[model samples]
Target: MRNDRQPDRPPLTTGAGWHRRRRGLAPWLLIGLYVVIGLAPLAITWLRGHPRQGLAHDLSSGLVMVGFAMMLMQFLLSGRFRDITGRVGADITILFHQLIAWTILAFVLLHPFLYAVPGLWPDPAQAVATLRGMFGSDALRSGGIAWWLLILLVPMAMWRDRLPIRYEIWRLSHGLGAAVIALAGLHHTLTVGTYSADPWLAGFWVVLAGLAVASLVHVYVLKPLRQFRHPYRLVSNREVADRIWEIQVEAERRPAINFAAGQFIWLNLGHSPFRLVEHPFSLSSTPADRPRLAVTVRESGDFTNRIGEIPVGTRAYVDGPYGTFTLARRRASGLAFFAGGVGLGPIIGLLRELVQEQYRGPVHLLYGNRVETQILYRDELEAMGKTLDFRLQLILSEPPEGWRGPAGELTPEVIDACLDGRFPKDWLYFVCGPVPMMESVEATLLARGVPARRIVSERFKYS
Candidate 1:
């Protein structure tokens, strides 16, 4: 093994003035706020001291109220707000959003069942009768609308890929469905809620619902307006690897979008920013390459398959610099990067940023691909070792003839062999790839005693 170690590595660049600073609530504080908001209605209702319904009836109301609170919060969580995602990272935020969604689903779905529990014992037929009565009640019409929409919508999101609809259509439907659920649920609550008749409790529901709708307005309306002012023009588009493209857009305004490397952007090319034609792509160019932003997109989806044919100088609008897959707010004595296929997009950006900043830490990359031709930035990666303390390991599962190198999936054996048991406690690990690969790599590192906090990753798809 050829070993090249820089004896005196310089200080970390993350906390320095070089990268854009990200500030948000600590994870504990954020969780605390979430719990408070979700339980606020329950607390307020308890204090109102209404004549208590029996345990089952009260429990049903409580569950629906908390679930409704959480459902409303979902809008803000998905709005891509930096203030919330800054400290904890986008991965944890998104995972939390997803997990809580399932919880909300459970709570809402159980609402009617719990309410019908009272009629279940003596005659099972009575439980069905109770349910039918609840569903058929004219006063509960808004509640019924919300209930049915939840049944149809949540599954649609979970099984989106299985559906025949396009992603844009699904996204629009999801947003509109969420809005309806919020409004209908609110009307149901204020109209028939036990404690919502109180002015203070009704006022709280109104305020929170307003904030929820405002979050949607912020993402769909306000953000698009801002993009119009800070417009960009697509300057170049070219293929970098098999079914992969690198696209660049130059800013038409004064200051470019300030972003940390390893972040991603939602790009809208030759379409109005207000339209639902944009797609998210990882930033392949370093932040130092600003005023001309670039994203590396894979031809995997409907919109991306045609990216290669986009003419140069097309009007482009970007709504990002989103995601926390960067080293901007972290400190690591050494860096280990794992990328599979097109996952290299952000990793390449991080490496380029390190080179531009002259980072002294030892950086090792283990890039995996199915075949040699699928490897991207081959020359650039091979040349990195000459400039920085870098090591490049290209692992191909299906090597061509006369090839003698690491050959396999990025398994535990592959990872251990690549790192050679170095800095398991100190080094920061970045893993980006397919879901299964990332999950397996993350579990492998954890089993090797790498602290969970030291690993960073971002996920766009969730089940």
Candidate 2:
């Protein structure tokens, strides 16, 4: 039998829950709107009564127009707008951005080639000669430039990690190159496109292109100006575990940025926001500790390795309160958390919130590390167990002698043991860790009768 005790937090049927429901639905609304916009050019071309240039030429023009619309919308998707990513989560947003890029690229690549198909065109040689003329003509220079630039841009982005350039340099070049592509693509469309000669369609392209440029300016200019106004100062930086460092920042004058328990921010230390020196990190502190925020970072990348050397009182900027990995927008009777290595950062913030809210439901935490020394905040977790109806299970892949706790990876059997035959379907499970660990835990939960909706997970890296 279940305890059936109510938690101290508001019920899902309340006003707060309604607000969350609306927020969750907003993403789908935006997506539907985007699809409609992307397909609008086709409808306008039909209404304009443009003469059909056979099936191949018509299809080629349609593909290019739709592809250009999608390419323009890509700027908005990657603009770091909270309204866009707040409900869908940043990981999903970025993944969609990457996947959709390939689709648009395919359309662009096939646009000119489709007309060259021998059976589709009445005169194949004429089609080939037309293509050569278009490519060779100085009047169509913008189109040629856009075509080649896109060919270079997509591959560069896809293989960014394999490149020798620094991440910052690559990021800057990506933005600049994208701007050039958009401008050149716009010029080509207005000059060469048959349907774009229509006033309505021409106006549509101009509006979309203008919006795309505005998005860039917002990200690179306006947002940074806002961040400069409300700066933060580094208060403390300490090595917590093996290579993990706990960083704390305090608001200098303005109030601290309020955020949900499990959200993250792009932290820029000792650098202007325009420098592209920031990195995303999950918050490890709850809102209950307002005006002061903390993030736990592991020494992996170049910037993170020198985290210990950052001087206190250094100026910092944060652009965030992003990601939908928090309980504020979710509802459940009980809660379960699974963390691996530094993935504990957001989980710990959530646990603190649960404790602060006086949540009286069953809670379980299954944390895994490679060794005993790598275990973080062990004493604090133990202390939390005493304050709430919490059970903490620590698992180490390699344990020292005389160790009595669970050993080895968090396999299905180990997870079953951790649950101790208590499987609450109503409980919401949060899993954060390395990609493999998260996948395993999600699969095990689903296999054990947990619904997919009940299992929520967050990935540290999108790629």
Candidate 3:
């Protein structure tokens, strides 16, 4: 991996206000642009006396799938949409990505059936025989087999948890599967000659291919090469709790990157972000502390469990500043954070910001863990609780004997108890936790007169 990291740039700390401001104008702008471009294409067809396939169901399905694929590619490359829209949150993003992939799979299966099953179609056995006969010479025939292999491999990678597979191996398989899909689709388009037979279809293919190539360069080559130039070295690492560690990293050169609190960056230890094993982690430190970044992790998976094994002075590549949940533009009189287990990573970042800004209003923290041992940053939270205008409530699901703090999950009752009238109804709430805990907390908040607009939550997905 070459040193390809870019020099220090302005931090992308603007919050939802930026997105909201754009949102209002975006729809009208998009509508106007759509009318212009869309109508122009239709008008061209009319002027040329060509038949237009207006909005056929099959064509709509195909377009939707392609549009989603384009969005995925855009996200995997730009990292801009993810920052502006929670669409790219760790949990939400993965779910939608899987949904889109499965939807495409459905289109893949249905397109042929709808077109061929009724009439003007070869029988199954005859079609198979014909396919086999033409395999070597026909690109579409070869690609048909390739498509099946892609369909097989992608699903397997997605459900790899059910199999005896590691994340690294699954990631590699997923990438290869995508490559097979792209090549096969390209071949099929060139050979089948349905839409591809048209000059306009050729133009569309060229654009998609160009975008795909650009994304590939951004992910695999350009980004990794830049990381080589701005290598961040681990300066210190310490165990924060049982099976948890806090790592401090600093740049070795003048152009050290500064990361915004609550924003996440993809970390590459021995390999670059392009590597199959790279993972995203939120920066647990504030931007005021320049030239260094801190990330806290629990031993939840292979990569995290091995964090303790990473030697001091090891080089790392950071590929982000992505995420919408930040303290930059939030307009709340008071702030509340609910964290479950290791989900305290972003909460800690928020706390640091509050402390730095000398926020005098109420700030409440409700953190839950299985045991006292699993509670990360316990001492720091306690100290901050005493020093700032903040309240801290620690809950242990399974407390040891003689333990007197709150016990059990962060249920509605637990959240209510933690609040204890310290904050008002209009207080801003941020929750980060495992899926179940977050869902429960968010529901509880909404039930307790906290408006949906006031509650913010983040869900972390381990992939």
The CA lDDT of each predicted structure is: 0.85, 0.85, 0.65
Q: Which tens-of-lDDT digit does each residue in 430-450 have in candidate 2?
A: 999899999999999999988
| Candidate 1 residue 58 C-alpha distance from true site, Å | 0.9
Cα displacement (angstroms), candidate 3, residue 140, comes to 1.9
Over all chains combined, what TM-score does candidate 2 have? 0.94
Q: Candidates' TM-scores?
A: 0.93, 0.94, 0.81
RMSD of each: 3.4, 3.0, 7.6
Poorest stretch of ten by lDDT in candidate 3: 1-10
Say which candidate scores most in TM-score.
Answer: 2
lDDT, candidate 3, residue 113?
Answer: 39
Q: Rank the candidates by TM-score, best first.
A: 2, 1, 3
